[model samples]
Target: MKSWGLLLVAALALSGSYAVDRNNFKTCDQSGFCKRLRGFKPEKSEYSLNLDTVLVHGNVLSAEVDTVDTTAQERKVLWHYAMRLSALVDGTFRVEIDEVDPLYPRYRTQLALDGEPKADGLKLLSNENGKLTLMNSQGHKVVIRATPLKIEFLNKAGDVAVVLNDNAQLVVEPLRVKKERIDDEDGNAVEVVSPLLCLYCFCDWILKCRQVFVFSALTAT
Candidate 1:
């Protein structure tokens, strides 16, 4: 009887850790950043690179991106964003972007790239016109386009991942400061807002993972 009870406890612990709730997540439309980036129209991309800051060292390239803000009433806002393109030793390409100088740096979870990619065998093909193309050791072609930048991982089979600043809605708002609290007639400061942001952030992540999985599966099949 003790052995059976132990077995049941172990099974419950393992299952609890692996449980995933699909409905608790948000979709692409729910995430402000993802929605803005994915909705980008290729035809409207007037992406330009700051050639002077482009640096290539070994397998990593870092540069400054000056993308046009088409959604602004001014027609465009000169936003300074940083772009890092690295070829992982494992042959998986990585592309990342964030605001160069915001009032407060946004939080990014590095745990997102949790696992190492299998040895897909990637090789650099060409770098020209603000674009870099690489052919994986497995013959898969990955393209990294700078200026209104985007990253597309593709193979002879089809595209695996395509991330673009499509609608040019990249908005990294500075975290605002709260004003001094004013006490109510009862001599206590009233609660202003609830802690909903934490919940929202987690939901966004799960949504992104689900969307990516669905998109990859569809493309692969």
Candidate 2:
């Protein structure tokens, strides 16, 4: 615990000399990523997978994904996306969703799988009405609820173990670029990075897991 506290202190020091309200942990509003991404909650998801383009290779299944975004002014932009599903050896499925081509590069998770996932092979049960389901003999299941944009981890009895986007709060962030400005007498402005942007990239695990639940949780001994 002493070592952990020291590391935390060092991290705060590296971010520059700022007033430290050590007693207070800032609210969610203080987080730029939280403010920007959670500002608007959509009634429904606008993403759909193109089943016709689905490809299977070993234990990895992939396909083209599509989504439409509407601006506050009511203008809409069509975006391209991609999806990959992997069947793990331990009766688990790893689903990856990402954007294909965007105006700017977006953030992707940096967390690596703790161990190599064994490919147990998967059987596609259905792909109808924009919904997809995959299952293994152990009764473990992966279901993608496309309309409202949710994913479910199901147990053998068809009970939901974990759910992502259950609150209808799945907001896809578009690529954001740093703004260049000039504020000095010489007309030179230093680029300032929002703390929220830095935190979002640093907190990759929150986005990477996407409601992951393992049989055992990790803990430091």
lDDT of 2 by residue, 1-221 (tens): 99999999998897755665655875768866666656554543355556687777777668876664533356354666677777766666766655675554444444465656567676778988877787754667777766545667787767776676666554445454556455777777777643222213111135543322233111112
Q: Give each model's whole-structure lDDT.
A: 0.53, 0.60
**Can you give the TM-score per candidate against the true fold?**
0.46, 0.61
lDDT by residue (tens digit), candidate 1, 111-177: 6767743333345677788787766444556666766555566745766654444444333332334
- State in Å the error of residue 204, model 2: 15
For candidate 1, give the lDDT of residue 178: 36
Model 1: runs farther than 4 Å from truth? Answer: 1-48, 70-76, 89-91, 108-124, 136-139, 156-221
Pick out the ten consecutive residues of candidate 2 with the lowest summed lDDT: 211-220
lDDT of 2 at 17: 57
